[model samples]
Target: MPLVAPTTIQKVSGESQVEVPDLLAVEEPLEIRLGFGPTSNRQQKSVSVTMRTPGNDEELAMGFLFTEGIIHQPADIVSCRHCVQDAQKEGNVLRVELHPDVIVDWSRLERNTFTSSSCGLCGKATIEAVRALTPGPLASEFAVDAAILHSLAERVREAQLAFAYTGGIHAAALFDANGKLVLVREDIGRHNALDKLIGAAFWQNWLPMGQFGVFLSGRIGMELVQKSWMAGVPLLAAVGAPSSLAVQMAQEAQMTLAGFVRNERFNLYSEPARVRLAQMV
Candidate 1:
């Protein structure tokens, strides 16, 4: 499906209104189904359904599964594709076939998928529920200069093709220590964008992204931090602010968390040592 759609809207400027053609970031529900169990007794189940801009869906499913602790490595997936059994479900339903050896504990996955893209961790009983799935504190020596961090926001903006048209999409970008962009993904949902980026990295064998920093175009939340932590990304920066719980989570995981990463300034919430600041003359 297309990432953006065309619509007509009234352009109100000063005192006059004129109808003009415009584009909007498309939003649609994507159902992610899981195929697991032994060869002799295969089973399929719908794991999650998230509203997102339609693109890079396979990567989104892969990223969601990995971050949700369903699969560990790229080898865990046999195949991931859109489900077409029902023509009506085409492009909106994805099925991920996992290696038979990959055991899935369904109990841990008991939650509604209807609101996952918005209310992350809504049904969860405790924060530890997700913290347990995430890897331990990051220990990599990866670091970036404050100046380089400041430049990332503009780089991300320049690469956001969909946002340029709709101005409603979010993005997740991965950059090397020198501030070079490695990958970028955009979606109507912030978490979905991160999932797509991580999904691409997971398939490309870029897990344990210790040498790279991930930047978000929106505010940092606890769920976003958890997802980045699951990918082993040491540094997480955002153009917006970080939630109190997100900062605490990053601190506990020993990850470097920075927010308000624009205008040559940013606030470091955790692991400040990883972001080198210039000394006074």
Candidate 2:
């Protein structure tokens, strides 16, 4: 199905009234389900029902599981497929089959399809209660030029085919250490976009994404930082402000966070060392 829909809106600025065709990003509900045990004895359970833009559905599901701390390794997923229902309903449900040995920690989960600030525990208490679910302090040696960081927003913008048409959608992209964009995903939901990007990596056996940087087309929030950190991304840059908790989470995870990346100016919130500025030789 097409990711956008056509709508007519009346333009009434002064005395003139004209109907104009406009494009709107399609938002729909996606049900994510989990199946465990051997194929002969598996049981399926509904996990999340998220409203998102359709495209890269499989990648979005995988990324959601990984970022939510539900699945740690690519090998943990035996296979993923859309539900067996009809076309209209088929694309709306995603089922991920897990290996028999992988035990899903249902009690420790604090999963969501949106939002990025709190991981069940909020503020200082988050450090104690939820940090165990995330990866340890990053040891990635990936670094990029500050100039490169400053230009990342445009790089992401040029590749945003969906945002270009709908303007109402959000985007998340993965860039290699050389400042080249490697993967891009767009959705009406910001977190969904991030999930699709990481999920693509998961399907391609590209976990431990410390070698790549993530760029967002919108504001940096606690959840985006948390998801990127969980995916092992060493650096994250966004076009808007980062929440206090997002900055705190990034610093605590030893990940570099940059915000307001546009017009040749950007702010570094944590792990500034990863952004190298050239020195006069």
lDDT of 1 at 170: 99
* Candidate 1 regions with alpha-carbon error over 4 angstroms: 111-127
CA shift of 124, model 2, Å? 1.7
Residue-wise C-alpha lDDT for candidate 1, range 74-148, written one tens digit per residue = 999999999889888789999999999999977656631222232346423334555677667899999988999
How many pairs of residues in model 1 come into backbone collision?
0
Clashing pairs in 2: 116-222, 116-223
Pairs clashing within candidate 1: none
Score candidate 2 by lDDT.
Answer: 0.86
Q: Give residue 50's lDDT in candidate 1 (0 to 100).
A: 95
Candidates in order have lDDT scores of 0.89, 0.86
